[model samples]
Target: MKTAVSIPDRIFEAAEQYARRRGIPRSQVYAEALARFMAEQESDEELTEALNRVCAEVDTSLDEFGRAAARRVVLPASEW
Candidate 1:
């Protein structure tokens, strides 16, 4: 697919230099960067979904003792 997008001059120059150094086409550099970015986004979405599922199943409420213990863990002696 052919698409034109606006990018900063500095970034375009850097990508051009990188492609030239690697003996690859400019399109390949953009394609690989886009593919890697999409993969990272997908992984982040998966991680968020997993965290949501875990949060939904787990009890978040703290009993009095649990709250006290958490406070102790979070607070310094001077603050306590």
Candidate 2:
């Protein structure tokens, strides 16, 4: 599919250089980049949905002792 989109000059120059170095068409570079980006976004959405489903199914909460342990583990990290 052919499409027109605006991009920064620096990005365009870098993509042109990359295509020349790899001996691939500019369109192929853009297409591959777009494909990878779309896959990453899809994976993120799937992970979020899975987490939500698990949280909904599991009716649980930390006891005071468990919460204290968690707080101990996290307090040191917050200082950094």
Candidate 3:
């Protein structure tokens, strides 16, 4: 698929240099960058969903008690 979007001159120059050095098409470099970015976003979304599920399953009282205990045992950075 063909797409056109403008980028800063410096970033364009750098990406061109990167593509030339790696002996790959400029389109391939942009494609890989987008692919990696999308993958990271998906991974982060999945992790957040899993964490929310687990947190919802745990007892709120237990969680609050742990927080209270941590407050008692943990010292302020200034004190440390």
Best by TM-score: 1
**Clashing pairs for predicted structure model 3, backbone only:** none
Candidates 1 and 3, the one with greater TM-score:
1
lDDT of 1 by residue, 1-80 (tens): 99999999999999999999999999999999999999999999999999999989999888999989877876665553
Q: Is candidate 1 or candidate 2 better by TM-score?
A: 1
Native-to-model Cα distance after best TM-score fit, residue 73 in candidate 2, in Å: 10
Error of 2 at 78 (Å): 12
Question: Ten residues in a row with the worst lDDT in model 1?
Answer: 71-80
Would you estimate the TM-scores of all the predictions?
A: 0.79, 0.75, 0.74
Superposed Cα RMSD, model 3:
4.0
lDDT of 3 at 74: 69
Q: Where's the lowest-lDDT run of ten residues in candidate 3? A: 71-80
**Superior candidate under lDDT, 2 versus 3:** 2
